[model samples]
Target: MGTGNADADAVLRILVVEDEALIALELECLLDDLGHVTVGVAGNATEAIAMGRSTAPDVALVDIHLVDGPTGIEVARALSADRRTTVVFMTANAKRIPADFAGAIGVIAKPYSERVVASTLDYVADRRAGRDGPACPDGFWPAPV
Candidate 1:
């Protein structure tokens, strides 16, 4: 729901930094369904940085493991250089993300569902709006009422 780069009410231009083709495709579809646009998909650190520069996405959904290697964290670090970009790590091994990595906004575990994705986005929106009360504990977003 929230990985793409979007303002509060605008369609987000998203940059998907996942190496898996199928997962990347599914993410694109889900973002589109949520009224976001997939600006590009990257499979490695190099590609991710390139896409970030060209697309200037509002947010990036990055996987910790990338095509080049375990460089997802590197990608996130690089993308965060842009003040307008928010980085969210998405990986099966969420434990890899550092507890105090300021470059990232948050993370969501892999094998997520449609509703989870939607809720995650909503949570990100809250974060951008400065209403994110606390760091989401384990990314558990309550079901929308």
Candidate 2:
């Protein structure tokens, strides 16, 4: 666990809840490059929720539509119930997200760039540390708290 300080080299335990194998792999690799750990990768709501409970990751990057269907929202709702985990939607269907954000902190539009993802992770880490990070990244939409 991080002390919530950005300069502390916070190595977040992140879970990738994307169904696409390639995307998941890329995110895992990116997380490693960012000096963060990829706790787990889940391709469905069931697996996502299970991993969330078991791994207790600091953050979860979820896709709206999974292999099972549009069950990512369900996974978010469940995971966010545990304050230990912060949920962020990583979906192409941004418009499909409910206004409440399913208890998530924000949404990152798909086809994301490495820079954007890196910036977003930093912002999320700050927020989790109880610090208000800088303005949201270009393709990110922070949910109304």
Candidate 3:
């Protein structure tokens, strides 16, 4: 959880799924900067599944398209099936995602500012803390229960 909060319980184990090395690195850095744990990263659906099984991430920042295939959409759904974990799509191809994607809480479009990511994640933390108000950020929809 990087160096932000000293309280270990506040940290979130996050799974990152992006094929591009640089983007993956940046995403990891960003999550770390926000004091979240990078449980693991995977470039494909198979590895993503494996990581999810092993890490049991509290949150997942998934890309819609991976090097292996455009399987991230399904990956997000599968990961979100575990009620404890929430999945958010962070991709350049948000337009391609179906509006009614059943298993994701929200989508954070590519080239998003760090502030946007932080705010969204802060909202997740609040929800995880069992305090909830609105579903998601202004532009996103919450995942179905």
RMSD of each: 5.1, 3.5, 2.9
Q: What digit string (tens of lDDT, one per residue) describes model 3 on residues 32-56? A: 8878889898999999988888888
**Each candidate: how many clashes?**
2, 0, 0
Model 1 per-residue lDDT tens digits across residues 61-126: 889999888899889989999987878788886768765543887677787776666666656666
Clashing pairs in 2: none
Q: Candidate 1: which stretches are off by over 4 Å?
A: 1-10, 129-145
Please give the distance, in angstroms, between residue 14's alpha carbon in candidate 1 and its true position after superposition.
Answer: 1.0
> What is residue 123's positional error in candidate 1, in angstroms?
2.4
**TM-scores for every predicted model:** 0.81, 0.91, 0.86
The best candidate by lDDT is: 2
Candidate 2, residues 74-95, lDDT tens digits: the string is 9999999999998999999888
**Which stretches of candidate 3 lie above 4 Å from their native place?**
1-9, 138-145
Model 2's alpha-carbon lDDT is: 0.87
Which candidate number has the best TM-score?
A: 2
